[model samples]
Target: MPVHDPYAWALDFEALGLVPAVGIAYSLALRRYPAERWRIACFAAGLALILAAFVTPLHTLSMHFLLSAHLLQNVVLAEWAPALCVLGLPPALAAAACRRSVVGTLTHPLVALPLWLGTYFAWHVPAAYDAALRHPTSLIHVEHGCYFVAGFLFWWPALQNAPHRLSGGTRALYLFAAFVLAAPLGLLLALIPRAVYDFYVHAPHRIWGLSPLADQQIGGAAMALEQASVLFAASTYFFLRFLGGDERAEAYRSLQRSS
Candidate 1:
């Protein structure tokens, strides 16, 4: 009976509050340390993407109507934004954060990988996802929070200095395993004959006449491709590093030292 305005660009006033909060937090946290401009830019870009996903019409669509939009939000929160935020951390800051005993204990590839996969898959189960959608607004935030944290956990062990150091070859294999194993759920959702979750069936208006199921399928495909692209690029980096031998490895290590 109701149609959403496809051009709707604004809603969720509370979401706008996040940008200044994050900016202030970042400024205060790193105030003592002079951060590189590029790192600051990365962090700013990550924040901007997050704001776009939640503060704009995307939030209205995701929270009230469409699963596809929600999935896109999840991708931004779980992967793109968090990765950039982590990368933006200065090397000393990153090392210090990673060295915390709790971080040390949990961020090992073995622990982090399983934890990430479990959280990711568990949340995608129809009952779980639908519950998040149906419950109090706080539940939605919780769901997104879990996804964000899990993503960071999964990615951190590879990029930062961890307690159990992985060799370049091992890192490559680890990334390959992670990306490959995490992909099938999305692929299945994308190709399934029927909609896997019923939550979005009544989503207000169809975008371009795409049915709810089609939207879900599109979301799944987007998830698969987005992650595949990121993982492929990262895997290449690690694989190339693995092939570079100790001489090249040491040379790069030295550059890191000098920075």
Candidate 2:
């Protein structure tokens, strides 16, 4: 059975447009600065992939009622979408954009921190999930936007690709804390015995005809997998930096001893 309206899927291209628009706007605004084209390309490509996922038959087919299909959708939204968006950040452009008074205030860790947390919580709420299913196109815009912003903020510290550059140790600590904080949420979702979202529970859609509970479990798994990817990548980078710092310190001590 069809999970979504074809018309709704077609209209969803607007969500994809925002990614390039934001990227281009930032690029043009900071054209004078030495920019990273690779990062811009990653950002643009990520948005394009997300738009392709939803606007094509992939989204409808996945929503048709299979745990794996549902999991794929979650991966696209939570993991792949965010990762690509962050990869496109050029430190110079970020610094330029941060010069704007309002942008600086909003991107401040204090503000971005809570917004990230709120976006995570709000989308997972049962009501919100149901609303997203009913109004697929509009909710997609909101969902993808949240993912993009959250990813950008999360990467800010580690990449130092933002207006604010945090010390290596600080970035490491942030990554650690984020991993610890998000673990319980993933566990909670994974442990749920039944479908939490009403739309999935009641909808006639079925991928390979899997049950709604299974689909929900798959969604939880997707969240866990994405978190694991972020934690592993960030931790690896931090560890390498830490080891290099230690080596430098050891070399300095050897020189002092020789002198």
Candidate 3:
């Protein structure tokens, strides 16, 4: 019998390569546009998180051992990493990209919301999920790529300060809708009676003695919790900004009347 090694490191050269490639590209962009220090920091952090996800044992566990680990990886790839990277973009660069007709259209809130939601649920279909795991080299790559791209589009309009950026109030509402819309999948995964993805159920070795159904439930719960926390924070920030703007406008009107 072979001992299971959940903590063993797993490296994905293609994924790891993205860190330096993106860093170099960002550096070049910074030279041209001179982004603020925080923007640079956000980009660096995003790349670092991406590197962590692929280079750490998280990758190994996700690939072969645990549904929860895989779900966690998806959250990082689809939400945290993409959001930070978009936030890190230089204003000039972001504006230029947003001005492009295709980018503008796809990133429009109406279009982006559905695309992201579709990608999120479609990939989670048990058959599709199992196929990706079974063919990790090809289908898995496609799955992760789609998640990242869809996530990038999902966050672009809300976070990017381009000419077509949504107003604070509208952005808040958009995020609220996203939160509401994205919740069902996670809830389903968590509350379902059985394990939906056979990849994890039939995994050669179970980690920490968690049953497939338990692992699935944990993954689903994590997904829902993360989405709720992150989206709520973002939405509240935008909503507050909307309120502050209204207050400022009212103050200006009062000053004009007094004058």
lDDT to native, each model: 0.78, 0.65, 0.89
TM-score of each: 0.87, 0.77, 0.93
> Residue 87 error for model 3, in Å?
0.5
Q: Judge candidate 2 against the unseen true structure and give its global Cα lDDT, from 0 to 1.
A: 0.65
Sorted on lDDT, best first, the list reads 3, 1, 2
TM-score, candidate number 1: 0.87
| Residue pairs with clashing backbones, model 3 | none
Overall local distance difference test of candidate 1 = 0.78
lDDT, candidate 2, 138-242, per-residue tens: 775577567656756655555654666665566677676666666656667778887787777776755554688876676677677777777767866776787
Error of 3 at 255 (Å): 15
Tens-digit lDDT track for model 3 on 1-259?
3555789887799887877998999999888788898988998898888888888999989988899999999888899999999889999998877678898898888999899999999999999999999997899989988988999999988988675656789999999999999998899999999998988888878878899999999999989999999998899889998988974686689999999
Using TM-score as the yardstick, the better of models 1 and 3 is 3
- Which ten-residue region of model 3 has the weakest summed lDDT? 1-10
lDDT of 3 at 187: 91
Candidate 1 lDDT by residue in tens digits, 1-259 = 5566655775545457767797788888687655799888988888888788877788767766678888888888888887777666666666676668888777788988898889889999989998898773578778887887888777777776545667777777877888898898778889988876667875555666778778879889988987788877788788888787874669799999999
Give me the candidate number with maximum lDDT.
Answer: 3
- Rank candidates by TM-score, best first: 3, 1, 2
